[model samples]
Target chain A: EIADAAEALLGAGGVKVGGALRGRHVLVTSGPTHEPIDPVRYIANRSSGKQGHAIAAAAAAAGARVTLVSGPVNLPDPAGIAVHHVETARDMLAAVEAALPADAAVFAAAVADWRVAAEAGQKLKKDGNALAPLALTENPDILAGIARRAEGRPRLVVGFAAETQNVVAHAQAKLARKGCDWIVANDVSRDGGHQSGIPGGVMGADSNAVHLVSAAGVEHWPTASKAEIAQRLVARIAVALGPQESQS
Target chain B: EIADAAEALLGAGGVKVGGALRGRHVLVTSGPTHEPIDPVRYIANRSSGKQGHAIAAAAAAAGARVTLVSGPVNLPDPAGIAVHHVETARDMLAAVEAALPADAAVFAAAVADWRVAAEAGQKLKKDGNALAPLALTENPDILAGIARRAEGRPRLVVGFAAETQNVVAHAQAKLARKGCDWIVANDVSRDGGHQSGIPGGVMGADSNAVHLVSAAGVEHWPTASKAEIAQRLVARIAVALGPQESQS
Candidate 1:
């Protein structure tokens, strides 16, 4: 049933999948994590999951045995991929760790930076005194943890830096700090508002213009459909792995 | 294509929709609002939009002309409903206001309480210094705004109280403060962790146990699937509207 839906969506969208990463295991994370505030509410991010889902679908098309650890997204599961759906960031990390031994990994989900430090088990409500103050706590750095894995880490650990300003600089620092091999950065800034003549860039938008920042330097990729970007990125990963490494 | 997927999901789940609310213009809000921090990141609440979406579907099934003003969610658009998808709380409020003169309204979205006071046009990056500090500003109170509308207010204004403890007390206060006709309060507290003993109630779960609180009194409903809860709620709303008001 899931495959049928994927096939229909792909056919309707005219998406192409290839076999560049064939015989290799590739992992992808997509969407937004919901950090629980109470049973009813949580801290989350606005991640359309388009780019990451596109990447996962593209990777699968390229013949990699793909395991997509996805956050809550509305998209139909991509064809020929094993998908693990999780709600919270903690749950997402656990799922990722369980699906290791991959040739490459992509960190694409818009994970919340922080959660309520001390969560109230009961629903927090107004008492006419004043609005409640929320204490903050940082979430686990999933990309950093995977990149710095002591053993059994994927050969290529890719991270994403979603920025509005100084894209390359932040990507470089993130690449260094997260200890990831490559960083995919895109400009998400709005000069004024989205109504300021320019289109909505990166994040929730359909088309993306990205810059690839690596230890070697920066390479700019032209604006293209998310599917195109994924296919290209997967092909690049395939090249990095080489024939011997990618083959089962 | 969206309808096809939704049909498949509904068929698989065996969800039932009816026409108790025929001809009534019922507006519903669902999901979590994204408050922009930068272009890529946002401050959001943890709302899966399941309960609200279920309600929208239920109202539509019952023959109501439903308009769902939704935030970003992965769930498929409810079949046969007009869905206005927005990202931020302000946008959501605008959408809600535009759909005015509704016969009934359900404020179910877990709107973010605050937004970044100063939005940055550029992507915020760490500059070999301390982490950036976020200044918060309050978000528009959609429920209150609608409930307190000077004119063209929906006959039945419903709000939700997702509480952990003292459910009734908080909901009563919210009812008084928000000036809504009724409030649906639910206890989302898990006795232990999600894996401990009992399953996580409400939130992202398929089943929900809730309390319908109003000026009359508190009525506890037993645990049921989200669909079942929605259908029952819509039926109750129909009765409240009475015979002359509901029919087209």
Candidate 2:
């Protein structure tokens, strides 16, 4: 059935699939990681988990048993994919570890960089005059953590870079710092309006343009729907994973 | 009021006057360049126009009277900025050239790489089993064109690479091929899923993680809101464009 669908989509130039990632275990992280400021308030991004969810869907469509470690979002679980839901960045990390021993990992989740040093169980009353600064500490970079894991490190690890200016420069830095196989850099600024809403909203926009950077060099993909991008990406991954050789 | 708002946004840290780009005109191309397959079936992306739009906003925020050549996206025009909208890649190139006398240029628009060589006057009939293969040809690389221009070449030209494999290697190649100062690379594969839409379908998501790659080295930014990312990038660009003494 899948082959027939591929044939229909690709026409005469049907996708050549010998053994591309036939039985690969792929792990994906999506949505925004929450860092608790208090029981009620937390620091998080306006990520809707649309991109990550779509990727999970695409991966499953490509025949990979996918483990989706997703953040808090209202998206329905992609059909035929296993999903684990969490809130804070710490919880996400723990979940990734539990689903480890995978062939590859894609860190698409917007993990928070800082967490309140202390979570206040109860809301504190504000003094009338001045407020003291809340202390913050850096969260563990899940991509780096997975990349530097002592055992069972996935063969390929990818990270994301969202910048407004000098996007390439910043993305290069992240590739080195995260030690991941690839980094997706984009600029998200107010003029662009973040977290707008779905279908047309921030989390579920249909189309996207991005820069794909790695040790090899850069390749620019023109604007296309997320689903199309995912299909192309999955095909590329199959090739990179030695799909043809495995099939033969 | 705009100045005050900018000052407040800048807080204590701000771009220094008389920098590398002090007198340079910078033109940035952003958003998704549309290709009219038909009036209704045009090709685009989930680009929210966020990254490119943010780049334009940030450039203006950094004291550049940026002429933001944008594509069709439901975004409010940034204040204190000049904007031009175009539909196709060819139109985009024309706009970029019109915005000439630029000191730098950032080709951030996700221009469609291929377009239907000819557009059908009306929607073609869906005859059973007889599908028309849409003839496609490559669109000119706008970044490469600007970089290789014989006359009035922008001192600094940046191109974006959206690749799925061997990202760094590919970016390096683009840097040389596009003949630009820098190349922003990203992995828009299933693993990275940078093109996801927002929830309830309203706004574009607000966070991203990326790398800044260049000849110097790669710098990584942990996951953060796109707004924060933009601020940091603008700061970097200011430094890059600033006077040698200020950069030091």
lDDT of 2 by residue, B24-128 (tens): 466878776656443223434334667777877777766676888987666788887789988778989999999998866878776766555665433232233
Off by over 4 Å in 1: A1-23, A79-100, A128-133, A148-153, A190-200, A245-248, B1-25, B54-67, B75-82, B126-135, B149-152, B191-200, B222-228, B243-248
lDDT of 1 by residue, B1-248 (tens): 32233333344444533445667889999998878766555666666799999999988887889999999787999998999999889999999999998999999898877777876665544443214345566788999999998998999999987766677888898999999999988765665222233324455777777888888887787677888778767767776775535233
Residue by residue across A1-248, what tens digits does model 1's lDDT show? 32343343344443533555668899999998877655544556657789999999888887888999888777899988899998778888999999998999999887776666765555544434214445556788899999999998999999987776677988899999999999988776664223243323555677778888899888887678888788768767776776634233
What interface RMSD does every candidate have?
3.8, 23.6
After aligning candidate 2 to the native by TM-score, how far in Å is the CA of A36 from where it should be?
1.3
How far out, in Å, is residue A97 in model 1? 4.3
Error of 1 at B102 (Å): 3.8
Query: TM-scores across all candidates?
Result: 0.77, 0.46
Candidate whose DockQ is highest: 1
